[model samples]
Target: MLQHLLRLSYPTPADHLDPEDHFSTALGTIFSDDLANQHGDRDALITYLPSTYPAYPAVELRLADPAGEDERRKFAHYLWNAGVLMAELWWLGREEEHKWRVKGHAVLELGAGVGLAGIMSVLAGAEEVVISDYPAPEILQNLRSNVERNVPSQLRPKVRVEGHTWGDVTSPFPAANAGKFSRILAADCLWMPHEHANLARSMRHFLSPDEDARVLVIAGFHTGRARMAAFFDVVGDEGLEVEEMFEMDAEGKRREWRSERDGGAEDHGERKKWLVLARLKRKTSINSGSA
Candidate 1:
């Protein structure tokens, strides 16, 4: 197990120390072993055990062949968004303020791909989780296979898989589901500036009416800052407000992207990868009585 951990580029310091040093060390060992011998002909199984929720079983997923031409170009199997999603889940488990967002709430994940975020939500005790992606037959099949393989039989009833295209507010998700989801998730779906409007429209249509309802969005810097900024602009124009945002590097170092207090200077270029996470809520309007 330790050898597999080394091969996977895990932090070296974690290996030498005892599990008592940190909970994640023990969890990482378990996952390293599970994934060591799982890579097969067309798929690979990756495992994750969030340190915050030790009681919950490690999340195991069988990823489709990324070498497929359509799969590679469509960005369906990349690991960037999944990494950020896992970190956010760990953070939520420890933070009292945001922990309740998943438990007993109606959750929706857009561009679900292999359904990592949505699957994690179910493990976190979400009342219901809806996973959606493009209507391509191969994509939907791969996604359904993943949910069936990972989610336990008992919990499978709480999950729903569907085909959805961004910007189309009518199909797949019916009128009855509108304003029903308390938490919506979008990961690594902001690379295309052209699709920003459609993404926002879907969020606006489905997000719950409660003021506290939120949409959790994350994306990597691989697409560049300009595209990310454009996505923010479109969402705002579509009536969503950013409540919090931050950037995290490969080492788990986080810096406030838009906060009252400045996050100290650091060289972002040195990091091979960086992710930005944001929480958004519907923009509220107030009507004033005539004076």
Candidate 2:
């Protein structure tokens, strides 16, 4: 018998919503520790059953060793804190004034490793959702499988999985998706300082020109807050402004975003617990880039 990942477990109820869709974010996570997780990965077809989401089905991920610097590293193997934070925020999303959600919006998830945010967006009743990542065959295949199995069938039409390399304007992805996404979600994607400009350019490319359009970002402190700051520098260069930014711990304690703590006294444990969540919008004012 073959293990087929199916959406049979996630059914649409008569109320036009899911049973646990609007459950609650007060608890921060569905599963205990690391925001709840599942497991499975091994041989033949060597299909991986990487169960990152507690509420969703396992995705089939096949790892391929790359030759160039383009494939130097891969972060899709595990579900990080920032990814979990975004998912939990969108779970119920009633804790704050600016609730994390995608209802009635065209959502585009950048660097969608394992497609967690976009998958949750579909459950949150988004108008449409496009889950994207590097134009890697193995990665894109896994994204498609996850979307097919985790998202409700009726809403599958509203979701698209595409191969998108950040800032690659020379390619067709940018032109096709330009100004189409009302809400762009990026989680744990600001780590590489070298890629900040490219990432920012991609955000500008897909982000809708509408006043209400915004980019939702959540990055962990594990990689150093300085890298996060560098990403914002590029965001400004790309005509984007930080509407709001804050840090929240795994235990759900919210705080204002600030400079990184001293490196010498840094606590790896504490760093693992903190995540910076921010909202970015296009700078529309005449003197938008003055800062």
* 147-257: candidate 1 lDDT, tens digit per residue: 887788999999988878888877746455777888998878887888899999888778887767888887766555666667887887777878878786544567767
Point out where model 1 deviates above 4 Å: 1-42, 65-72, 81-88, 92-100, 258-272, 286-291
For candidate 2, write residues 1-291 as lDDT tens digits: 011221212133435544343442112344334332211221112222223344444433332333355553756544555765676673324576354557899999998877777887887688999998888877788778777767768888999988888878667767777788889999989989888888888887788887688899988877766766678777888878898888887666878877667754667656656878889988776242221
Runs in model 2 deviating more than 4 A are 1-72, 90-99, 286-291
RMSD of 1: 9.0
TM-score of every model versus the real structure? 0.75, 0.75
Every model: Cα RMSD to truth:
9.0, 10.1
